[model samples]
Target: LGYPCRDLLRAWIHELDPDSRQRVVGRAVSAPRPPQLKKLAVLELCTREGSAQVVAQKLGVSRPTLYNWKNQLLG
Candidate 1:
């Protein structure tokens, strides 16, 4: 399957009940991973206008988080 399909399936499976998922896989499954923010992408967004508030709001993260990501990425 394509990457998109695999990602979709993975997301769908992650949404399944833990018991059902364990039953299907015959083993314990870890919790779904959090969304990862790319350092470069975050830095690039920081460069854009209205990124501090607008972009951060759209991304569901705080404005300070954008700065933290930028600083960490640069260091």
Candidate 2:
């Protein structure tokens, strides 16, 4: 599935109530191999206008790691 833009994602996350966030986390945990929360976090960070280096630094992940997650999530 195509990932939504960062602005949209931020808005969605901001609008989600605590209960809804729990449901999302719960759904992720239900997967056979639960997806990494960091991967999802990286994806969100990429939506911002930051460069790869900045995004990775902010998230404390490598640029390659962010790129890998971006491809996996977007592709």
Task: Give all TM-scores, in the order shown.
Answer: 0.43, 0.42
For 14-47, candidate 2 gives per-residue lDDT tens digits of: 7875345433344323223236865666567667
Write model 1 residue lDDT over 7-65, tens digit each, in one string.
77777778784345443556655454243554544865757776468877876666786
Candidate lDDT scores, in order, read 0.64, 0.67
Off by over 4 Å in 2: 1-36
